[model samples]
Target: MAGIVIVGAGECGTRAAFAARDAGYDGAILLIAGEAGLPYDRTKLTKPIVPGEAPFGGLSALRKPICHANQLDAAGITLLAGTPVGKVNSDARQVTLTDGRVFGYDRLLLAVGATARRLACRGGDRALGFRTIDHAQTVFAKARGKVVIAGAGLIGLELAAVLSGQGAEVTLVEAEALPLSRTVPAGLAERLMARHQAEGVRLLCGSEIEKVTPGFVTLSNGKRLPAPSLIAAIGVVPNTTLGAMAGAMIDNGICVDAQMRTSVPGIYAAGDCANVTLPNGQRVRSETWRCAMAQGIVAGQVMAGQTASYDDPNWLWSDQYDLTVQVVGQVADRPDALRQLPEAELQFSIDSDGALIGVAGIGRAAAMTKDIILAQRLIRAGAKVTARALSDPAIDLKSLLRTQGDV
Candidate 1:
């Protein structure tokens, strides 16, 4: 039988396989994993490595696998783990594996995900990139003593928090003026920097790593810092080599439509590997786990001959030092348009007409979850909200929506 082949058995690939089955596609389903182990939650790796008291154990320590091999088998999925696809014959609809095995597919889903971007410097090999469980384990083992991180992005900040919690002298280096300046507004970034500082993390903004030695690092600002261990969490580059080799269109990532259909016929792309075109003709790629899962399901459903489109606003969250930071829609693009609510932790961005376009919240998770949900609704509906109403904690969000007849 011509099978539905999924490449890169991370969250996106595994979820796509399951979604295809759930959508009632009976054809053979093949899930290929480049990594050796069974699929597990990559997001859970950072928190558990700290080895402190928490409500949850490590991802693998849980009884249930993130995507169990047995469960995939039960769903009639042929899982090829530890196997890497060497090439893609787009015209023939066949994939050549590194081990010389070939598989033909009626439809293909390329969810190859991404790899962490590394810093270019001498002794750079001494620095680790945290994208996989193995990398997390290696970093965790060597987290003692002074550890310098190369970026102050989400991953870098989270790792800094985790390592600092474990008694490591953590220093974060960033080229941007503020932490997460490109992702969140300056106010929220300032709060995050404050939180990190409160946790004893050293922040080095507007700096770059000029050179690295076995025991130390030199900054572009003429500062030398101890670096027994270094980690680079600058960003990620989408794994688009296979798709590109297959003649798929590539921009920032593999280009796909709302249906996740790639440029090549019978091929689709999702997760971090896919840059989806929005309604306004803007192409964006989300690296969050939620985005991967959502895009995978939509792609799977579309591949199964069901109509589906991924149109949800980009949403992501970060947990750091008792703060749950949530951001939805675009934040950085409208810096001047952003308005801080009376609640110091809440902020919103509006269009020219004052219609809500984005929302960001940072505070205790318990206090911010409901507000975040409401803010998401307002942003989705493009509701025009007054600053007074948004800032007033007493003004119920649902009531505000009802008052605007948005309910």
Candidate 2:
């Protein structure tokens, strides 16, 4: 009866199951996932899961041999794939599956993940947002020449790079003036725009799709483009309906506290579907793989009667072409507070106190720099983010390290 049940066998649920076993919780751990096959990295879908690509030739999209689910199974976790939870009766301590089976659990973890958000424009239903493996495969199979993608979000830009790099004429339309405006500043967005343009991908900022017809799309500027495929990377909505059905508090995502504990006792939520506020006063439902895994570990540890708190310095990365962009901690909530570093190399998000809240870098730097940023923030210390400090050419890093008190 002390067993833990995890819903949604993505990175979050799988990590919780593995972590539970690794932590010596020798009880029945059940992972219920809607996806039929093994859990693969969803971020890699835009890059490798597209059909007809060299990487998508075989079952390699699932990372054959050393797969996500396989690794979980190796840790003695029971996985129930292709079976989704239909309803949760938290009061009665039971979960009903779509097939009319009920399972009881002492502790439950909600890692249901999220679904891609759809635009409310005309003919929007005809568009597809990449959220699952099947969707990516279907989109890639149907994609041929000239694809019109709406939205300049991470998913849209990543897919544009993949399709365009593979010889498809890609036209990416964004309503915002810059790409990734909500996440990155204008300078980073402009640089990303330049990279996409250099690779022959058409960028349309401050543009909207007026209408969509078969094999063609009409733009707001009275321009009609021909394309057989359309991808809408607008945003994502958390999979919180099940939690709501069970009478759990729901916000943009399932609202949780610093401990990943839901409003209801014995029930917890984590991953992209759970909206959590960090110690630094930043609230975000991060969709990054690392956040999901780390949250899962924390949830699992808590479910197994551990007192540890989930205080992760959130980080995310996107791999497009040869560029690897890494973001650490929460950027300044205010747009104007973000300052760009010299050579357009890095950007710092400073709080009202002028303490660094986050750091985002464009070019490669020492891996330790990223680790230090995360480690310091995880301990709730000053971010130490300064433009002159990072840009000084003559400053020795060793001396700078000596100045800081024990981290």
Candidate 3:
């Protein structure tokens, strides 16, 4: 029986395959992969730069299998690697491969992830994109020389950190005045900016690119920078061709309800290609690794005749030169409160009712991670924490959480 079919076997697709089994769906599952080779964790692509290694294993070394043969076999998931889907016929509940292979499904999950947004400036095509493993291979091959990177967002900054650690002369240019303005709080951005500069990263915020040649970049101000290798980590555009062709509603992305069901019945989407629509008509754009996993679980469980919905707070972490930054709850960089610790600094976003909505922390990896997790739990429980209490290092957050009746 053609039980369930999942397109685009990234983390979301692969996880959903297993999640269906965990949800007790005893049926056939087909997972179509766009890229060949085993599905690996995409988050490890630009993290923890390895200094001067032989034959280049920095990326491959971090290839944690999303689903191995043993796991797939045990979970009873059929994985078709390197398959390009030609068309998704929702009316017929079928997915057709470019090679003309047809597979029908009781339910379909489209996790066709996003592609790197390219630069629109003149000669911008010269810059390489950093997305999949193939994209990283090209960038990593030339990272030993002078490199120019556009955009100071998370992707750009992380790439800069990795390349700079490898002794490359790196320049990071962003259109915004500050890096990570949207995801990171202002205070953390300042600290991160300083760290990047100290580590020999030429960060040029509030900058624009005029043109990019094969080996050089010209800024709007006529500053020509040497670029033996150039990369664009600007952002991503949702890959919604198949979903749209299948007649699903598309807004900022393929619109999915709380349970990850698309507007079309028996169809759903998750991961980077999905925008979770709320009851109030707002869409939540969650594109991180954890977010993908969460959405996959929701989609799979709901598809397997179980009830589930994705309403969790979004959280993500970034690693750069021994410093790890994590944010949860209210993502606004401008926080309503601040807490300064020796090992880490916490920025808090509190609601008007005095409930802690968000928190951003940066410092030592160990300290930052612990505090962030605690803050996430508190925020999830809608803890009405005050600035005064959060400000005092003496007042333990765990104690405060206990008062709210959460373990």
Query: Which prediction has the highest TM-score against the true structure?
Result: 3
Which parts of model 2 have CA positions greater than 4 angstroms off?
49-70, 279-281, 332-344, 364-380, 383-386, 393-402
- How high is the CA lDDT of each candidate model? 0.84, 0.75, 0.86
Which candidate number maximizes lDDT?
3
Candidate 1 structure quality by residue, lDDT tens digits, 282-302: 888999888899899998999
User: Could you tell me every candidate's TM-score relative to the true structure?
Assistant: 0.92, 0.88, 0.95
Q: C-alpha displacement of 120 in model 2, angstroms?
A: 2.4
Model 3 per-residue lDDT tens digits across residues 103-174 = 999999998889999999999998999888888777776666688999998889988888777677889989
Residue 281's lDDT within candidate 1 is: 93
Ordered from best to worst TM-score, the candidate numbers read 3, 1, 2
**Candidate 2 weakest lDDT stretch, 10 residues:** 57-66
- Please list the residue runs of candidate 3 whose C-alpha ends up more than 4 Å from where it truly belongs after superposition: 48-61
| Per-candidate clashes, comma-separated | 0, 0, 2
RMSD of 2: 3.6
The candidate, 1 or 2, that scores higher on TM-score is 1
Query: Per-residue lDDT for 33 in model 2?
Result: 83
lDDT of model number 1: 0.84
